[model samples]
Target: TSEDSEPWHIYTDLGYYSVELIAESQNCGADTLLIDSIIHVLNPSFISTIGNQDISIFPNPVKDKLYINFNKNLNNPMLLNIYDLNGKIIAQKDILSVAPGILELTFNRNKTQKGTYILRIQNTEETIFETKFILN
Candidate 1:
């Protein structure tokens, strides 16, 4: 019940299942419950990976566009900031929208010097990932 303001049980067609509850000071007296009593459920798996740890940059010695892929959903309106080796912001773009899949970023290396640069990807709150690349 909402008296405890916590999810206690999930109910399914077959039976009732209990869920872990986070006790709040206001819920000390009232017990929250979730009941699951359904049956004939299929086992489903949903995989989601976070952070930029698993991201890859192809054609490291990039000449043109850079491709980025993630296994998880990224924040809407992601921010891409490119900085030179001297820590100067060379380019910046706001990714208005992103799907839960692969993303491609095109950079005109012709304007950038043939050296190392830092690419920073920031979501709404924090920096999701960062990488360095060279243009040859």
Candidate 2:
């Protein structure tokens, strides 16, 4: 039920399930909180992949500009989103047009606090890739 001091992850078969979290104070009779949510799990096969697109992001400990490169012949537009460790979106871009070899994008870094962040690339329908990076 527990791993390292990090977040707890629960993986289950495809189904609708309700999960609850209980937090209690040190005092046995102290205040407690109950947090709950409904979780829906879809079959992995349904979301494994629709099309293949190779992606790469560089200058990980980026100073100003974070560059992203993609490899594939994509006709439809793709969206790139960057999020801070707290899951807040910090930057986003839509690749409106490109030829059939590779596409590249750059996000300007300004006043962004130094920390870890997540990079996600997706289409309107599904998320294709996600990775982590650092800002310095």
Candidate 3:
């Protein structure tokens, strides 16, 4: 594709991607010319509405446990909940005192079916962060 070409719309999972563009010619002395580009797709399910810019999660297609990291803490009881696709609550937990650091939690995959689910992190009054995850 050339610079005047329109942008391509592609839907993909969270991961690193590398793309290459090549131009081939038969009459010219050169056989081909190539250029490369890279991109990273972050999980869109992870969103924070409380202005918490340091929240992040890893291992989108988690097998057992997902790692969540927050550079700053909300200083409140963080309510963590997992819900199925039908809006049914599958698991929930309440952390009374969350330190201004990383937190590790385990996910039991045996209780729920293998599919996409929603993970919500919030307080008693409002939601702070919400993201989607897949259980295998």
* Number of the top lDDT candidate: 3
Q: Per-residue lDDT for 87-128 in model 1, tens only?
A: 899888888766667677776756765666677888788887
Global Cα RMSD, each model = 18.2, 7.7, 11.3
TM-score, prediction 2: 0.53
lDDT over C-alpha atoms for residue 78 of model 3: 82
Q: How high is the CA lDDT of each candidate model?
A: 0.63, 0.62, 0.68
Q: Is candidate 2 or candidate 3 better by TM-score?
A: 3
Query: Candidate 3: what lDDT?
Result: 0.68
Consecutive 10-residue window with the lowest summed lDDT within model 3 = 2-11
Per-residue lDDT of 1-136 in model 2, one digit per residue for the tens?
A: 3433444343436776665444455677545344444766673112122334466667666766676665655667778788875689988888764454544444455557666677787877887777776666
Superposed Cα deviation of residue 59, candidate 2 (Å): 2.1
lDDT of 3 by residue, 47-119 (tens): 3234356777777777877777887756788888888757899888888866567777677656666667787
Residue pairs in collision within model 3: 45-131
Runs of candidate 1 with Cα error greater than 4 angstroms are 1-51
Full ranking by TM-score:
3, 1, 2
Worst 10 residues of 1 by lDDT: 40-49
**Candidate 3 deviant stretches above 4 angstroms:** 1-51
**Candidates ranked by lDDT:** 3, 1, 2
